[model samples]
Target: MSATGPAGRVQPARPGDPSHIGPYRIAGRLGAGGMGTVHAGVASDGMRVAVKVIHPEQAQEAEFRARFRREVELSSRVTGPHLVPLLAADPDAPTPWLATAYVPGPTLNQHVLAHGPLTEGNLYAFAAATAQALAAVHAAGVVHRDVKPQNVLLTPAGPRMLDFGIAHAADGTSVTRTGVMTGTPGWISPEQYRRGTAGPAGDLFAWGALVAYAATGRLPFGSGAPDVVAFRVMSGEADLDGVPAALRRTLEKALAQEPGDRPSAAEAAQECVTLLASQATQVVGADAVPATAVDMVTALWDVPAGEDPAWHLPPDRSPSRKRLIGAVVLAAGVIGGLAGGVAALLPGSTGGGTHTSSSTASVPPSSSTGSARPLASTAKDDKDGTAANRQASNGGSATAESWALTRTAQGAGEHDVARAVLHDEGVVAQELGDGVGFSPKSVRFQESRREVYLSYTLASDEEGAMYAETEIARNMCLTVRDVVLRLHPDLPYRTYVMVKEESGRDPQVTWQDDFVANSRCRSAADDDSAQDSGTDQDSGADQGWQPDEDGLGQAMIPSTDGAEIRVADGAARKIIAGTNGIRRTLGTDRVLGNAEIKVGFDPGNSVMYVWSDYLEWNQEQVESWADLAAGEACRALVRERESAGSAWPYSRYAVAEIGGSGYLMIRSGTATTRAACPA
Candidate 1:
């Protein structure tokens, strides 16, 4: 074990001790740890700084020296308002030390010890700020292996995180040895304790434990020997004696035993901020003025409501106010891993990939056509393929069937093919991969468009991996699907419609012959390959049509004018009729006018539509138009109209065998026009 101060008493500094170390003037000894001693100091300009120097004993260890060198390099690159800014360092010196902007405040542990338990509101605020700090740290691709209350300082500004002694850059040369835990016992995640593989999630687990302590003045695993505490943490049990009910769910999730089970610092920060905001609103009431809220509110005002505060900070402060300012600074610094060169490691650290082993599947370039043949199989295929193939061959005579699987890739990758296949069967496929592999289960086919999503995992039984996996998978699936549909024009898709007033109301349908006539006219102008008038005459005459009761339906009206008719109301619904005569609704109000609709077909009469809603805002109309007009214009862009035929009211707008759905934008008069999917 490392030596402590004589009799465990903090060593006192002598006046004649070298006043200057490198560029800093040593003022006083601040504290001492197992590996190093910290001294209060200042630059030539009298700028306060904290200098941490390696102990002579530890300096003899080559590994420790290298780690200290890495610490200097990492500290220099990390910058944030909440973190103690690393001003200088000299790793090559006989006595290595790092000088950082001095932050003055009581350690969080000291504060809790002196002041008792923190109020629920303050605890929530602290958690949020600390989570944000950790986010910054994680973003930098570094993990503060030691995330204890003692490492956190509560300054006047908020919180400033300190002590990166145990922090390791994701790509740094140093590798943790097995069975060597770098974190405090009680706050370490199960993975950290057992595997010595501390990552961003492990830091999040520590943050959760620290928050639990701050809120209730007690560790979640009860105050006991490190071994017992480690046992409890590894067993996935927590002692939430005084934790608030509102925060229990979040804390429980974050405290899950597995590293994969814990909520991300980003997510935790969001929840903490939300919880804090709710508590603040309750305390100040709805009628309270914004200006009088806590100083934290001032930082939150200019950014997103729950945005991490690591991105912004107040100006510099004087020494007298350092303690208060330092608290906030420390709070900000807690996001240690989110900035600098460390950020590059975040993507791979989450551990996600999707590839059928031993099977070569090539992603076709540009062209849509491709040939798929079964190749070499692996253990997974051997266990499931025979049954799957048997079922596929015997289950139905139809040419297409629905299938679903959990997405295991971080972003767009091979996992999408599975989703596409499931969609072809009219099944709503949900994604399951969130950079982190938390949720391990996925349900491919539910009841029609409404599918059951399952996230049960045997691995999660040991911790919160199940919950984390599920949330990440669902969120990743949604994000990837949405992004792909938005950016790729040729992908078959649909539009989203959000109704604030009518959550459960089934959509109403309206059809107009005038709208159909206008669609035909516009199609003639837009489609260069459209059949000439002679072809139109023959096809129009052959398909004798009649209008519906509402002067809509199979109408054969021909027009020469290139005018497109559209619906003005956003609440309108559009449906494209497929070969099976099933009408698939394309756009909801939210997705209307902003995205285009693409439809795909299967041999079994099943149709799939890919919705891409990438609408650019018309700044002029947005600024000048009335709310209703602006809303309509936005919707129009999403639900733009296109015609299939050249004849005015002929087969142009015919709702026959619609294989897919799409939108076309057009400038028609002063008002923007929108077309509803054919009902």
Candidate 2:
């Protein structure tokens, strides 16, 4: 809040203005805006100050304070002379008030109005200072959503950027209502008006507009009702009537409609500062910082210890750089003597695999242990403890999950975090022989994408152990997926489980299956290759079921683990006909376009898994399309089954649409149902 009267307007204190606020005495009102009212005051220490006190109604809104606090946090980190400095703040007061270092200056709006448009050199210098300030602000991941002439205070030492009550994070969050218009109209960025998150690039767009405004003395998108101006900005129709050629080239790129197309605030400022480098040296004066990003941010921002202002500042790029703090957790590996093969590693059982002679440790629910059950399984285990509970809390209230898991292995020294995640000793704990142990490395959670990436380094690098290590990596994917869903059930994201190969630091993405991506069923039964992977588990070879080979009749019932099918003769033909109907309907040029649809018979169940290249499983609306496509496909199959004297409803064979990052959704229950196994 620059003292309004020194070089600008002399507005009197309002009739209702208070004489005293906190320990300061209000001398006069400086200005009033939508966010708050600024007043020139005298502190108890006899220091002149500019205090901004929020309006009562706006003070009551929690989100306003959240944004204010975010602004304060970012502002405090940035003491650039061109940007306003946050001296002290008491936002929790009945009416929030923040103090800033008093500067006697007129805003660019007032300066331009009184002194006419700026000369080319003056405009370039002002843009340099503002850009330098913005670079510091943005380096702290803060975006000054409002960047116009009025927000700039034209002091003798360049220009100072102010009014940060509407600042937001660089990643963008719902600090404000979605799609609601924000910031001053004529100066707002196209993305800000287009119902999307306005990032740091938005501020740069505004900076471009401000530069244009100074150069031409006109609003870029012509002032009008916010709706009209927003329309113009979103449509890329700004009225740059008189911008000079040299400035126009730089400003045009800054005013690009796409955020990615625009230059960063730092880059734009550097261009102008570089052109006027000789003149800028004299412009810094005694208080203003020089024209570099680092100099602006690190210069006047430091406070004298505990006296520094209060507000949450985001940690530096990495947690390690945040502060000098450290902790050590007991990430010790599992220690158990092996007696049998890996396959018979199940609790209280002995198969061919190397078994651990350790007590079966009871794990709490999947929620407590971050355990999740996959939808599919290789072989049926009586004590597998309910693989997946399809029931939602509100009776299947969920449409379909858009959550996906993204696994990556790029973190340096991330073995500990990964070790802790895979550190659990489940009921079926087994130790593989010789040199095939994995040390849990690291796991990363992507909040925006809602995906988790886990990286594991192979503790052993012996020859001929790649296959065993890869299997361990596969197992980790299942374990990590269950853990992530159990922990973050509400997130609409995915998890990627990856392991470091024995040879190098490259990630061996062990779990890329649709089940892992969508957090759905596992396909262990279909993985006859797992037996050849040297794990001693029940190979599907002994099962009498062969829906694909023997067809889905009573004869295939023996192959099923527990389900009992009571299908009459010729039931397979009818089911095949019904499936064909769905294939033709979905495979048409319009529905899935030229995408190939692969329909495979689920081994034990009469159900099937319909995969299509056209399926965008990650989309929120994919479930409806899946239901429509599967419904039509199953309608024909059901109709044929009924005509063949079988009692099967389309509802019984309904597909539960699940989204995978780049995989086709599975129609779980109905895709494998051979011939109606009634309860």
Candidate 3:
């Protein structure tokens, strides 16, 4: 809930903090750092802006003023939709101050930690937007040396990148600290550590790490002491476990040790946009704002504003200024809110944090202080309701779940969103149970994973296994259709169909996949309409159960050893050709060394296993890789059969495996459209 913006209440101004700096009236404290303090201020025209004012002692130093002037210049030169626009600055003032347009939302780090990692459209959108932001930064000939989660604010519109404090011009006209490192430990580029100065490639490297953090809610380089984390960054060993495969490939290229090996900012942005296109239902142009991402980010704003806290100023640290600046600036671009005075508070106005909070602050000591503190929970119920209402107006589809919710602390009406989700979940459970001919033991929606889990008891027999697989596929498509039509179309969710032989036994997940209703299933009304119009081939029904190429349903069943597996050379050729087409369209160049396509017919199993090197990528990446392959295969199969005047014989579920060792089932059904879970 914490973000650098004008909507939330702020801490009361400290005694030493200026009430009026330039033409802006300081209302309250936004943050503080080594550079100065950031204040929530109002202009003469009543427009709210984050005002960053240098400390009186720092203003006395000529070198400090020159650096402040350089920051103002750099901020002015950079312009983009994803950047916090600088409004004004005056370096010659007794206390140098700068102001920037305030945006209301939580930082990426805060949102990920409070909620969880981003998924689906939100993740894709974030990657595209942040990459575009960097494109702009680079285009302006500015190298934003500090590009991390704390610097990216998630707003209802999209993400806005902050903190240009240490940003140096590509032409080297800026006054950067020559002796100190200018970026966060885990996010810094290897070349920066080796050469002492970072360029646009360094920002792109940070972008790779930042996107990975947003998708997984963990640092790409695992967190530890600054020196240790820096060592990992320099070693070029990033843990991209939870990242999607196709996207992970892009990150891998971006994280390459050599600067020339990394893709340009524009190229990276286009790549992200391409990935977003692969998961979109409708035609999304490169410039289109990702609506689902906007909605997901908007939901994070539905929290009550906190009461302003009392501000207390720390004692001066003039004696240790040099050492403090050297150490703290290298670790976190800015320092403020420290017990010691070495760190000063700055507001979002300046865009770098040294203090725990600031006008434009850097990342905090831990993960908490780099931006605004998380929203407090003490406001009136009506106020929280108002925030929720605003969220609705902003097109929030999913309700924001508090980091930790308690019945009493949140009050009676606070659980409305949770209750609503529960009600919808029950509805889905009932529908799925009715369709599959039995009640599920449990149905739970995990917001963090963006998945719905439904478990049912089935007889331990061949008939039961077949029935479970068939019904689960058919019903999962139907549920996806229902969710898209009656629930949230903007939010993508995976449906996990789990089965168990006995009530006391642990459930075995039969299939789980993100099925786009538009391409995989049709409403009952639409099905009837398609039949009546003699356009069944074009309807979603075409994606349902179908016979084998030999006009046999059960005869195509394969053995456990895959000995009876059959492959149509023509179908295989079509699939491979389609995969290449996709690769070309998306500009994906990463090819696994031992990439192999093993196609076979197995009616009894009805699962297509895609095995890959586990050491190179994790389970999620493997699944993502399989999903892409299967989607291409699905389209190719449909086309090949259609050309032969027949229906697609294969209804195989795609599953991912690690080097053919472990089975990691992925999709319940095939992907019939580009979107992962299109409406």
Candidate 4:
């Protein structure tokens, strides 16, 4: 969701630039560095991400790819408010790429060059925040070899430390290449130059130099040729002129010739925080930021008035639910930065989901093979035959390359398939024709049955969406059958079409069925197996379920056998444990079936939700699957609530297994057991 900034901030992508990378759609170029070009990209769920793709020449080297992979692993582990988090990565791809949550702001160097050196509260906050970022990096056993001014981005929230590209674990492994300088001139530590080794201490040296430079708008060590800077660093020469009295002493200690003499990142952060509180404003706690500091930092940027609203950093005064979810994601460490591509590699993550501004859905890897190969094989079964032939039929090597890229991304479930459709927006639109358009943001894919959910937002209200629902479904089916299905024809493709009102209410499912090119998109009467169209009709005709006054539906639970009840007892015990209870294996009963139900909690909202890839679009199929899952989950909750006399503090819970199907059968109830719980 990288915002299109003013001219110099984000440049248009060149003709040579990639239109898409993995599951992200590249929007514009952010910048280029030694490693590779960084592009502003958007995820399928409209999350803005900063994607860093390695240089082709560098990617050719086996050593570089190994380091890049290590960088991704290490970066994902280091998370903090002042540090950019790694989102997704595929170092094994032809040109290895990694994506991070996009932070829109000028680099520390850029800010200083345009607005001069920071003063008072702004300078103090920057130092403390950057130190906190370093502490987080070091806590993860990573040493950021390059912690220069240009790598720190300034935002209203505080400073964000970027580019752990050269960071390596503190286990003493060498990440440096022969004949390559690991750090920028005038910033590299004396130890790095003299002994050719850098540890966490070197990062401290750079942090001090960075803060000093920010205070005085000059390099701590005299700016000169590389040799001269190295000499200055080795000679322990540093200038702290014009620096504040209290901060100058700390900077002097940080620039000590001996690595051990410098304060630890934690100590430095506390010292800066203390200095800011004493001079500028009162700090509530050691960790709490002062309001004056944030105000000063915000004033320093001077962002243009008409810039994209998406570019605004979250307000410093209040924490919204969106920010709370972000905090949860960073704290949970389960879905830390590595959302799409590398989820399988994370310690206990079954797979990751695409997180949008509001909601998220996790899809486990192909349960059939427990690997990505099956997904690639699905695409290989394209109408044109083998991947090579599919490429030729599509008219280029780019298609083959993109397909291969899709394979790397397939580890994250439907992300690969979703990217394929989004990348071909033009072709999909051409097939849909006038008045009807393909909504890129509305496209959500499910890999299990090759189901793609799409929506059309009407210019009018919900009534308007209902009025044209039939026509919209017909157009959507035609686009999918004629264009999307032809590309990957192997799977029994099922599609769901949703109609959304312009007023922003939740979209309602209008169509849920498979289609073939044999006849024009028709009603269920024409296609016997297809479910009837219209949201209201599907609910009443098939399930005979009605919504309560709150519009919350109830999950229908079937009679559970004694064996299923016993299994539910064990699951109840685990759920009450409050750790990673949902993901742990709940021993299956024959009645429960094989499909695993994975649960997630949003502590911010006090809601627990379940997700499963086994659910389908058909009403009957959904009911069948929902019964088993709902009964088991409900029994577990009932046991915990009744036996322990504790409701576990969750106010509401839901079943959203068929996410992106648009027709989410959300059954909301209290954490306490309900009538649906098996007796």
Which number leads on lDDT? 4
Clashes of each: 68, 43, 45, 3
List model 2 lDDT by residue over 1-679, tens digit each: 1122333222455545666655556766554422345666565565555566665544555665676666655555654556665556665677776665454455566566676677645766676777887887788766667677766766544566765433332111111111122465567677665544667898899888888887777777764223334545766777677876667888889989899999988799778766555444445553564656434323322211111121121222332222212211111121011001100100111121121111121111111111222221111341231221222112321111312233332232122223323332111122442144333334554445444454444444333233433344344444444433433344443544332433422233333332244222232333221211221123211133222211211111111110111121122233334434555443433332111232323222334333333443445444534545454444445554555544342222323321233233333233222233211
**Candidate 3 per-residue lDDT over residues 472-590, each given as its tens digit:** 44444444434443345554454333323244432333434444422332112122222112112332223433322111111211111211222233333444454455554434555
Candidate lDDT scores, in order, read: 0.39, 0.44, 0.47, 0.48
> Candidate 3 — worst ten consecutive residues by lDDT sum?
335-344
TM-score (C-alpha, index-matched) for candidate 1: 0.41
**Shift in Å, residue 657, candidate 2:** 56
lDDT of 1 by residue, 1-679 (tens): 1111111122235332345666555655544322344565555565555556654433444555687677656655555555554566666667665555553355566567667767755766677777877877777766777677656666646666765433442112111111112445566678865665777888788777888888887766654223334555766667677888878788888888666767788888777777777766776675662443234433332211111111111233323322111111122243332221111111111011111011121111111111111111111343323433343234231011222321222222222322322221111111222222121122222223222222221222312322332223322233223323323323332211110011232211100011111222111122222223232232221122211111111011101111211221111122111211221221223333211222111101111111222233343322221223223333433343333222212112211111123222221111122432211
Model 4, span 308-408: residue lDDT tens: 33422222332322311111122225333322211011111001111111113322211121100111112323323344333233322222223222221
RMSD of each: 25.5, 25.9, 24.4, 25.1
Candidate 1: where are CA atoms >4 Å away?
1-12, 165-181, 284-679
- Comparing 2 and 4 on lDDT, the stronger one: 4
User: What is the alpha-carbon lDDT for the whole of candidate 2?
Assistant: 0.44
